[model samples]
Target chain A: MTKESKKDGGVNPRDEAKERLENFALKVLESVNQIEPPKISIPSRSTSNIVFDEKERYYTISGKTVTRTSANMRQVKKFAQTMCAADFCKDLIESKKTATLREMYYISEGWETGGFADQGRSDRIVEDLESTFGVKREDLGLLPEEDGASIFGDIVIDEGGMEVKATKVGRAGYTIPPTMSDVEFVECGADCVLAVETMGMYHRLIQEEAWKKFDALVVALKGQPARATRRFLKRANKELDLPVYLFTDGDPFGFHIAMVVISGSAQLAYINHELAVPEAQFIGVTASDIENYDLPTDKLRESDVQRLKQLLKDPRYSDDIWQSEIKKMLNLNKKAEQQAFSKYGLEYVVDKYLPEKLT
Target chain B: MTKESKKDGGVNPRDEAKERLENFALKVLESVNQIEPPKISIPSRSTSNIVFDEKERYYTISGKTVTRTSANMRQVKKFAQTMCAADFCKDLIESKKTATLREMYYISEGWETGGFADQGRSDRIVEDLESTFGVKREDLGLLPEEDGASIFGDIVIDEGGMEVKATKVGRAGYTIPPTMSDVEFVECGADCVLAVETMGMYHRLIQEEAWKKFDALVVALKGQPARATRRFLKRANKELDLPVYLFTDGDPFGFHIAMVVISGSAQLAYINHELAVPEAQFIGVTASDIENYDLPTDKLRESDVQRLKQLLKDPRYSDDIWQSEIKKMLNLNKKAEQQAFSKYGLEYVVDKYLPEKLT
Candidate 1:
């Protein structure tokens, strides 16, 4: 890593990011003038480069790197694309403007030879730059699509020069913005943050005033949560010094969603440090909850059985609780949703189930 | 239709719905006590039962009906399931409680032989109850999943006994809740409601304060949009007397989204009267917009071509403007998103494109 990327204190992250880009440009210029081919080395985001960090309890990209040179026919266009994307980032940083990945893809049409054939190509180049500079896409002034994760209760978000209390927002709550680098979490009275998998469960908790009762922040993850949600949760857990708990359906997919928050998905291992909340715990909708609560459930489908078997082999789900739950689900051939608690009553999840799990 | 279902002038809708359901139950009870086999007749929600309403410009269920009898081995379980769902709805109405459709699916587990093997079976049975009683699922105290649509600008939403200014909410805007039956729209200052196809463009307009400048309410449709959003828009247009405009990408799918708002989809023909906003207009992102505005464009994929061809034959797109736009898109084979205007600048959309369209 460069000195600019390593410096954590005093320096502004944006300026540091700008300096890293400048350094990258300077290296490319030096290579162009030298006897060697102009080249760039980026940490590979391939599956082989991902490693499970035992200490941090998250997956991260290892030291494996891929070097691209202008001399190679396959690498020349990619090399040019990297330089073009670097130039775009420099302009975005200088102008103090941001572009969504979609906008970036469209803007690349003006890049001539450096233009991307598809959005996936442009997206991959952005990730390459992110890993190479040891900076986030947000720091480079690139935004992702708007995510649906909404945060409510026991916290104040300093967003766009306004201190907005999460509790004061309507039942839908305050949506976590795409770019959160400028956001500050302040006046947090909550002891824990519950990242819920479904909106129904989240709204139930909000309507029932579960946050007021439990001193917790409720966040609707809305299925496989977008990157913004994960980043927000990680920051909330770290900056607010609050524990994080994930509540999802009693199914394999729900378990994976929880893992994505706690351990980070292998696909995005490169930026897991910024996204993953290693300390986050998985709260129920478990196989045991199905039997214990006598919640209504469906027989596991063939696909569900296959997924359970796969989760049993996944390294991230190797914990004792995960192992036991997966085995129980496979053996029992049943799966239930977070909404299954409604069989008892509308507020059963908020009143009975959550209280038991949280405490 | 029963007289109870037709009595819409003086009686409360919930009470009317309850009465209709009770009438239905009474008829079934009478049939059970008689010598004849117990049977129930319901308006079919199938494609064959759908008819285009030329006057209203929306699809509706025709006079076609399907009768299910308990004596038939193939339909006995469905007949029982329908009866059980009606019973469930009666209980919900009595208790004044609500359950999500997913929750209703799980709750069916206690119905013994009436239990649905999958969520689709349970969901279809609920829809069957809806068409049979001539009442909405919401009226039966059943809610759909939470939608992502958010409305921002000059409007007041009297939600859950509280008056909320849309502009006063945070940047994410006011999320249209699952059940908007109890919500009221008041203090509408906007001239038109812009139902935006993508959240990015919606947020851009809000961030730029376009609502204040143009006196318009910007709503994020978030793709195909859930039922609650459609109902919300229909109410905004009908009750608040604001014109509705759909802003979407220049593609077949985007065109259908606009059409769904203005003309309604055949799949949901039964409730089109309650949800369809026939007065809505399709604003820009047209095929000609690509050339006129010099917006960046992508070539239509195989699926896009196929859909466009299908829409060419669709009765809903028989309008002169729809035909011209679809033909233009097919001839050019180019599609552009609302974000395409970002090539000019982020504010270009809010300042230039929207103002031109609105004026």
Candidate 2:
């Protein structure tokens, strides 16, 4: 709503969402006043367009659809329930409260059915609302579902007209916000954004104050960044023109989580254009890192091997770099998780590993 | 290079593909003569359009593109190789011979370096040729890689100007071909089309002459019907307008095969308009049937249970009928394959089971 009011620092995503919700409601009311059932249209995740952009080197949504209204009763009920969720989210943002999606889904559990059978069904409707508005639920002031990830560096944001120097406060940098857009990205002086897959390695860098030393924004992705985190990083890249680098475990799943941030997951493939960080390049915790750093003994699990075989056949992992890395893992019969870096001692991440891998 | 010449019964799908290939080659030659590298454009299988038709009650493709000459000489080479594949297919059909997709992929193994690294890659490019041309590879005279199912029934086809009644010639029935379009549906006097998911159940019926007894066309899908079989079924339904009943094991994979006939697979989501048969209904070997017939105790496998759990969460299996079936399997801690009906004796399928389930 109203083009994300640009303030002293940066645009506030929460305020923008709240304003859009108001405009959407007003439109619905106008339609109802004329006795027409408001057609609440959201991009259907079920009917998604997943395309690989060769130039940009990421998969993106090139096609999508609004929710169907052919089934009259279902359409009306879906629209009404989405509106209810939207209103609840607005209240959360305004009151400076945050909710996990589970909390929001069951917010009106006993009193009303909301016609949802389980948390899965409820979450889909919520996603419909998010995709419909093209605003993440977290940016609407919903905290992340998982208790993971943190941020550190010279980034300032406008929170309620007050400029917040994120890295200056607290002993270990800033605990990431629910919806990052609630705070404006006022300034990013960091030369680059370094996204890490695990919290252990992330905190090691924060404790070392690596962000300040290396002029980087150190973000622990906590294995697949929540929508808000991805959105924030995407915006930071666009607004600040910062090069982004990623580090994950030398395993299929860890690499998959990294891909989720870089190219977007197939489950939410439609939202990639807005959330994916295309400029991000794989830094390390690579298969080769196991030998180069001489970390620890490793053996790939059955499931790991299964996933590796799939990645071998996957179209997205068709690039030469990905092919070689996967082939290396298959041949070596090993996988290294992020925590394996701990074997090298704490300072190894900040001193030896980070600097060595960055180049 | 003209349209398929409609003969006595129906248009030959193979002849049509051959004509299309000729027309396509001429277009490329014309362009090459004008000094432009010939770009053979096929609807990219990688890029597909899936639309749910309000009127048709199944998904359909509404869009596509020919991944064409935007690239350099490499793209031209790729296009030429794919054209070469199409040419080989055309030759196979004209010679009244057939080859599996695996055979076709390896046809030029020792000769040209089309840059294909594996059968999987070769298969995808060949599939793209199918999707691009809106024709099945089987219709291009290629057979399935696996031998799983069979059918001997009332179906008749126009194979190279000769009419062949599949059920009449043999002691049991006619063996289904790779490309059903190679044979036109001459006469489907059967009251209904009964598609069986497994070979055991199909042969049981054929051996017992169940199709004759019940006035039905019995087909053993052999765990997912080839495109030729699916096309034959689809055409029979449209032209003959026969009610179709699918009988499979009361398990997730069986149901999946049934769905492949009814709605088409996600792998083939793009070509649904030509392939999917919407009116088909699951007739028997249902979860409830086990109880009704008092079939033997067969505990569900871990894999079966896993697939059932996935089916429980699938959007396609969202209907109440599907929900209860999956729930019943979970509740009973048991599953039944189509062969399980043999416990009641082979005649049970033709006599007691078919009559009871059909109603």
Q: Which structure among the candidates has the greatest lDDT?
A: 1
Count of backbone clashes, every candidate in sequence: 0, 5
User: Candidate 1 — which residues are off by over 4 angstroms?
Assistant: A1-16, A22-41, A66-80, A93-96, A293-306, B1-16, B19-41, B64-83, B93-96
Off by over 4 Å in 2: A1-359, B1-10, B33-37, B40-44, B47-59, B62-66, B70-74, B93-97, B110-115, B342-346
Best by DockQ: 1
Interface RMSD of 1: 2.1
Model 1 whole-model lDDT (C-alpha atoms): 0.82
lDDT of 1 by residue, A13-75 (tens): 667889999998888788778867888888998888899998898999999899989999998
TM-score of each model's chain B: 0.93, 0.84
- Tell me the DockQ of each model, to 2 decimals: 0.37, 0.01
Q: Each prediction's Cα lDDT score?
A: 0.82, 0.67
**A12-95 in candidate 2: lDDT tens per residue?**
667777988888889888977988767766664663466677676666556567654424876766666777777877887787
For each candidate, what TM-score against the reference? 0.88, 0.46
